[model samples]
Target: MTLPTSYRAYKSNADGYQNLQLTQVDLREPKPLEAVVRVHAVSLQFRDLLVAKGDYGLPTGAGIVPCSDMAGTIVALGEDARRFFSVGERVCANFAPDFLAGEPTPENRAALGGERDGVLAEYVVVPAYSLVRVPEHLSFVEGATLPCAALTAWNALTGSTPIKGGDTVLVLGTGGVSIFALQFAAASGATVILTSSSDAKLALGRKLGAHYTINYKTTPEWDEEVKKITNGRGVDHVVEVGGLGTIERSVNAVRLAGSVHLIGTVSKGASGIPLIPAILRSIKLNGVVVGSVRQFEDMNRFIEARGLRPVVDRTFPFERAREAYKYQDAQGFVGKVVIEVVEE
Candidate 1:
C-alpha cells in the first residue's frame, strides 16, 4: 500500500517555555525491519512538560516530537515486518527501544520523547520488534495511555517484589501511574490505600476500588494514618511518586521488609530521605522506569482479560496539542490526558 507523502506532527523547539508547533513533514517508507503506524491517539506525561520547558535533564534537540505514549494502526510494513505485525493491526510503540525484557542497563536506557523522537504525530516508524498489540477491549485513546504511565505502574507492582493477594498497597496520588497502580492492585485482590489533595478524587479512587483514602493536605502526618489503618504494621507496598520530599514518609509507612516503588518527583523541595527509619524498617526502594516490550505484552494480556479501562481525564484534538500540554501542566485531571490524532 502507498503511504502519504507528508504528515502532521507536533514539534517542540528549544525555547524554554511552551514552544510546541504543528508542522507538516515528509514521511519515509519503513526500512526492512520497520513498520509505519498511523497514530490514532497520543497521551501526555509530566515529563512532557519538562521536555517542553527544556528542563528534562536529557538533551532534547530542536524539532523533537514530545510525547512517549501513542496508539495506532499499522498502515505499511517493511519486508520482514510481517513476521511480527500485519498491515492493519492496532499497536502501541514501546517507550524504550533497547530495554525489551530484563533489568535495565545504561546501554538500553534511551527513552522516547527525550533521548529519541516521540509519537506526537500522525504517523510513526518503529522497529517491528518494538510494537505491542493493543488490548482487544481498549479504545485507541485508552491504549494510548498505556506505554508510559500504565507500564511504569505495572513494573512498580510486579517488577521487583510482586504484590500478592491480600497485600495492602499505598498509592501516593491520583495521577496516571498511581491510578493505574490502584486498579491493577485491586484487581489482584490486594487492598489499596491512596492519598490525594482532592477529596473528590479520593472518592473516585474509592469507586475505583481503593480501600482507604487520605488527604495529604489535611492530614500532614498521613504516614501515621497509614500505620493506624494497617494496625501499626504499615502497608505491603508504597507507590512513592513524591521523590525526596515524601520518601521519608513513605519509608515510615511500610511494613518491615515491604517495598517502595519510586516512580516520580511531583515534589520539588525536601529531596532527602531519612535513612535511619528506612534502615530500621528494611524498606526496599525500587526505581521504576517504563517496562519492556515483553512486559507491555503481558500488561496488555492482563488488561484484556480483566476488561480494565484506563481512566482518561480529557481528550484534545490533534490540532489542540498545545492546549493539552497546558492542561497537563495544571494537573487538574484524575487519570491520563490524551490527544486524539484521528478525529473520527
Candidate 2:
C-alpha cells in the first residue's frame, strides 16, 4: 500500500478545545522498530480534555495532536518491525508505550496525548512493541476504547490484589472506566454496585450486570447506602474515579483492608481523602495510571473470552472531532465518545 506523505490531524495548543484546529501534517517514516498505523478510530478521555485545557499537569508541546487511544490498521512497517507485526494488522497502541510490563518507573512513564504527540490523526508512527493486536470480536471503535479506560478498569480489578468470585465491587459512575469495571467485576463472578446521578443510567448499569445501583444525587450519603447494601461490611473493592470529591466516601464504602483503585479526578472540589478513616480501616489506595502493554494484551484476551463489548455512546465524523471533544466535556454520555478517522 502506498503511504501518504501528509495526513489530516487535529492540533491543539495551550488555549484548549475551542482553539483546536484541523491541519495537514507531514508523516514521517517509522524507524527500524516502529510501524505506521492508519488510524481508523480515536476515543475521547477525561485526560484528553485536561490536556486541551493545559491542566494535565504535564507539558504538552505546542501544536501536539491530542488523544491517547486509537484503533487502526498497520499500513506500513519498518524493516525490523516486520518481524513482530505485519502490514494490514488491526492494532491499538498502549498509552504509555515504553512501559511494557511490571511496575512503572520514572524513566518509562512517558505517555501519549500529554508528554508526546498522540493518535488523533489519519496516520501515526509508533513503536511496534507498544502495539497490540485488537481482539477479533471488537470493532475499531471498541478496540480504540481499550488503551486507557478499559485497561484502567482491568488494572483496578486484577492488579496487585486481584478480586475473585464472591467479592464485591463498588463503581462510582457510569463513565467509561467505571462501566468497564462493573462489567469486569461482574464477569469475574463478583457482585457490582454502581452509582450515578441519573436513574436511567443506573437502570442501564443493572442491565450491564450491576447487582445494585445508587442514585448519588438522591442519596447524598451514598457511602451509608453502600454499607446498608453490603450489610455494614462494605464492598471488597472500589473503582474510585471521583477523586477528591468522592474519595472520602469511597474510603467509607469499602470493607476493612479493602482496595480503592484511584483512576480519575473528574470530580471538582476542595475536599480531600479522609486520612483518619482510611488509616484506621487499612484501606489500600491503589493509584491506577492505565496499564502496561502486557496488561493491555491480557485484558484483550479476557475481553475476547468473555465477549465483552465496549459501550460507545456516540460517534462523530473526523471533520467534527472538536465537537466530539465538546460532547464528551458535557459529560452527558454514559460511555465513550469516538471520532471516526477512517470511516468504517
lDDT, residue 31, model 2: 92
Q: Which runs of model 1 end up more than 4 angstroms from their true locations? A: none
If scored against the real structure, what TM-score would every candidate get? 0.98, 0.99
lDDT of 2 by residue, 58-118 (tens): 8879999899999999998999999999899999999999999999999888898888899
Q: Give the TM-score of candidate 2.
A: 0.99
Question: Who wins the TM-score comparison?
Answer: 2
What are the runs in model 2 whose C-alpha is more than 4 Å off?
none
lDDT of 1: 0.91
Kindly provide the TM-score of model 1 when superposed on the true structure, using C-alpha atoms: 0.98
Clashing pairs in 1: none
Local distance difference test values of all predictions, in order? 0.91, 0.94
lDDT of 2: 0.94
lDDT of 1 by residue, 312-342 (tens): 9999999888888889889899999999999
